[model samples]
Target: MKLVVQVKLLPTPAQAAALATTLRACNAAAQYTSRVAFERNVKSRNELQKLCYREIKDRFGLSAQPAVRVVKKVVDAYTALHAGIRAGYLGGERSRRRVKAESKPIAFNTSSAQPFDDRCLSWRYDAGTVSIWTTAGRLKGIGFVGSADQLATLRAHRRGESDLLFRDGGWFLIATCEVPEPEVFEPADWIGVDRGITNLATTSDADNFQGRRLQRYRRWHGRKRVELQAKRTKSAKRRLKARARKEARHAACVNHSIAKDIVAVAQRTGRGIALEELRGIRDRVRLNRHQRAIMSSWPFHQLERHITYKARRAGVPVLLVDARYTSQMCPRCKHTTRSNRPTRDTFSCRLCGLAGPADVVAAVNVRDRARRAWVLVNAPVPMAA
Candidate 1:
């Protein structure tokens, strides 16, 4: 199976500035492309991806700006999309221009996206000494992880297959790598996953794997960010950089830990795993701004994705179940009522007097749905690894 190890990039100060400029250019590129696509009578099909890259060069492309393999990855996204469209995938065409409102102009704190393929593999992992031909000059030994060989499936780069982002003071590169065919297994046990706004997640095994720590860290970090922003001095700005670096490390560590835990639990059970659908979770939730953001960023989707791939690596079944009424329904008595869950973590059934932790009950219900879906549905199982 293929696994992508995104080692951090230690770009020079000049490289960092170029990256920031590239980000704005990318946003400008995407926005311009989007406007062209949505315009009613604009028939002159404009290729903004190429245009953006070219325009940025005209405006801010310094001869000394480091173009390295790192920034070219951004251009690769456009190339990949065009290739797909040529290959008959219409969706790729739309994604090439789907600019959302929140997509602020790419700035210093933004991560750039890059595409990867056999052609671009020249600089992907060329020994411990990494070098890329750039508009500026060759940058070497930036930081790389693992061998450069990639499986064909994951080689498809539609969106930010290689996503670079700036947050909390440092830059993070998240490479999207695909694994080989998944392994098939006869599970030894069964699992149910419950996702909720209040608690984040609860598993059938009574394991509480919520993002409490992440929330705490975000809160503390937010305060520090505010303190930094309140400052007008140059030194204070430098201090913010330190804080950002710390946050990036913490975020990655948190995500990796949560993913490992979820996978570990699945492996330990040696049984099929199931998770409630997250699509409905948001619609059903009435969350405050903070709660909404937390629920939205809980990484439940990423967790599910991590579980599926990790399970395949270990040979296990992963299932998804609809989440409707999972919380209000009593696991013991099969009693369903809105009154069954009146608060954050309590679920009590009026008819059966069954009371339990709300998330756990939902987990059980979700598990049941998975069992039913697995037994009766004809959905294709993922190919064995």
Candidate 2:
């Protein structure tokens, strides 16, 4: 798995200016490459970009290394777009929207840092110092002090991948490390997860994990954000930056914690985790402005990703079931109806006299979907091949 870890950098004033200059260079490089590719793709032969890069470099008196890196960046962009197209998804520079990868990226071979490659990027944190080998030798000033602990004991293993990047106006080290397979573990159990507006998640096992915690944090930051936006003063802007960082940190904490808990419960129960399919959640939210803002800010995808990664390490599998009618379906009679859920939280089934918390009923339904999916998975199919 490739994990991109971005450690905070406290650069000195002089270093900051140098890095800013570097960023401008990167922007110029990207802009130039983007414009070239746009022009090339318009022509009949877009595949001859490597030759084009050489021609441009020679014509412009630019070094091969940075210019080549620039070409590689654009190539990677096209590769991503092609992959998305293959997957029947919209990606890459398509139509009129070609957002180039503006981040300065430098690749390194794993032979230099094997074994420990999965976790940390060795090149990123070299000998407790940021020993980045960019087109411009070693980065000076604030760059060195950027890595946490100066990356003193960093090492990459044989089967690893590393990419160093400076993006979001920050330096980041993305490490791809291989995880060892577990000797004795299983991810075959069943546990239903219910995602709600009020509570982030509730399990079919009657266990409750409230999402109100996230709601609280979101509201707090949202209010401050508005107040800061209105001020527009220098001090207010500075304070807002700090506050924004704090809010992001807080969100990471909550989402990470929530994912960990769900994984833990799945491990303990020895069952697979099933989650509700929240459809059109982003657009269908009936929350107030503050609450809606908070809801939107919640990192749902990040939370799901955390659960997946943690589950994989622990030998637990995550199951996604179509939550189409889980909420309306009666866990008792298996009858799905909107009227059964007369109230928001109450699910009083008319067909089977089943009644419970709407979310809890939804949870049981989520778990049942697992069984149905299992049958679909293992059932014999008509021999066509």
Candidate 3:
């Protein structure tokens, strides 16, 4: 398992300036590489490296490691485009967008960090001081501090590739570390969790985790965002942009908390977790204007991601089951129909007359489906010739 540990760095003023200059140079080379690749119809990384390798080094005055990383950054941009194309999420044969060079966070490959090669990014850790390689040169005796838990991991696990990040007037080292995978739990019980817009999560045990507070929070910010955006003044626009980011961060934090609680409950019960596989739901399902707005602001995917990593780390298995008819399907009589759920938050089976909270019913169905999936996955398979 790969875990990224962010360590706050304390660099001298000279080192900070040098790091900034290096980042500028690296981004410039990356931008040139991006422009050339797009203009020349270059796709493969090998072709890109051949085209820009020597020229970038000479023109940008960058060392071999920084030059190569620049090419890699450009290649990564194209890679994202290709992935989107393959997934049918983008509608274009090729991406024509060019990278504009800016002072942004940069990644350093193992080649750049010659001395630091473990399962994580190699760093010379002495007491609280660390030494890392930068494009300018090796910056030694940079102070970094992390929590006790984080420091314990630093001392235990192997580090992988590291990134130099400049955020909020701080230069930080983001280190990737490889932690051994925990033993997979063979669950005898399963906890079903239904995720929705109004109620963030409803477990099979009938615990309803409502996001009314978050909803109110977002709505308040959303109104302010619209008001500021409509003004179109420079200050308003800046505040609007900052508000958008803050809103996103707040949403992510809420998702993390919800996921933590769900996973913790499942762990306490000694059971695996079951979630709905709501892939491409926005495209698959049609909704009215109000519904669409709610769906757009929903953080289901982020919550699922948080649950997955947390579950895995805690040795609790998680299963994603097809959510088709899970809401309408009656857990009592196994009758499937749209009429089963005539109203939101209420589920009443037309055939069996079973009634309960709609979300809890769906969660139960999700768990049942996941139980079947788990059985099927563990079932024996015949040999094929």
Candidate 4:
């Protein structure tokens, strides 16, 4: 499994300036390459590299390695755009539009992160620093720190590339490390996880991770944000933006904690995890004004992603099944009706008179779906009679 370890860097003023210059040069090169490629209808990475390699170095005054990464970056961007188009996530004409718009260079922010590979970047674990190649020169001994676990991964499996990021008045090294995937295990049973707005996650096995505090936090922040927006002052605007980020950070921390606990439960129980595939759910579901606000801001996607990676790293398989009718369908009676979910939290089966927490019932349905899928895939074909 490949994971990113973000380590905060403490750089001197001169080193920071050099990093800024290097990143700016890289972005400029990428923009120029993009412009030329789009104009000439050049989409191939090799072709672009052949065309713009010398031009970027000569025009941008960048060294060999940074020049390579710059060209690669442009090619990668085009590749991603094409992939998105194919996946239907992006409009077919988006790439063409972007190409046509390249006549005017896009204004880049100061924090455009630059990528560095082994050729241009080196780490000194003993000194707790890294040496990076910059347009000005090689900036050495830039101090960095990470969690003990992250540092261990750096010492053990640090591979591939790292990005230089500047955010919130601090520099960070986002290192990509290739770690060994956990050994695959055949789960004896499966646990279903239903993610929601009220409860972050509820398991079929009767574990509920509450989101009431998180909701309170969001409501408080939302009110503050609205107040700040109305102020129309520079400080108010700044504080509003900061509050948005703070809310996001808080949610992310809570999600991480919840995912960790869920994965730990799965590992302890020797069970795989089953999750509902809720992609594009917000657009699909109809909600009232208050429900819309809460549901719209729900971080179900983030929680699912966190659970997935954590489960995979822990050797527990995570399955995503169809979420349709999960909340309404009764697990005991196998009856499907919207009335089964009489309220947000309560689910009562109309046929069997069985009732339980709405989220848990939904989770049980998810688990059953996964179990059926596994059985179908693994069950042997019947011989002709």
Cα lDDT, all candidates: 0.60, 0.61, 0.80, 0.87
Candidate 1, residue 377: the lDDT equals: 64
Whichever of 1 and 4 has more lDDT, that candidate is: 4
TM-score of 1: 0.61
lDDT of 1 at 358: 88
Q: Write down the worst ten-residue block by lDDT for model 1.
A: 101-110
Off by over 4 Å in 4: 91-107, 227-243
- What's the lDDT for residue 115 in model 1? 32
lDDT of 1 by residue, 27-128 (tens): 444444444333432222234333344544454442322222223433344455447557656444346443331133222213444333323223444343
Model 3's lDDT to the true fold? 0.80
Whose lDDT is higher: candidate 3's or candidate 4's? 4
Residues 1-385, model 4: lDDT tens digits: 9999999999999998888787778888888887887778888888888999999999999887888887777777777766765675643455666545444433345477778998899999989999989888888889999899999998898889899888777889898889888886888989999888888899998799999999999999988888888989999987887788889999999999999999999999899999999998987888888788888789999999999899888999888899999999999889999999999999999999999999999989999999998888789999999
Ranking by lDDT: 4, 3, 2, 1
The local lDDT score (0 to 100) that residue 385 gets in candidate 3 is 94
Of the candidates shown, which would achieve the greatest lDDT relative to the real structure?
4
Best-matching candidate per TM-score: 4
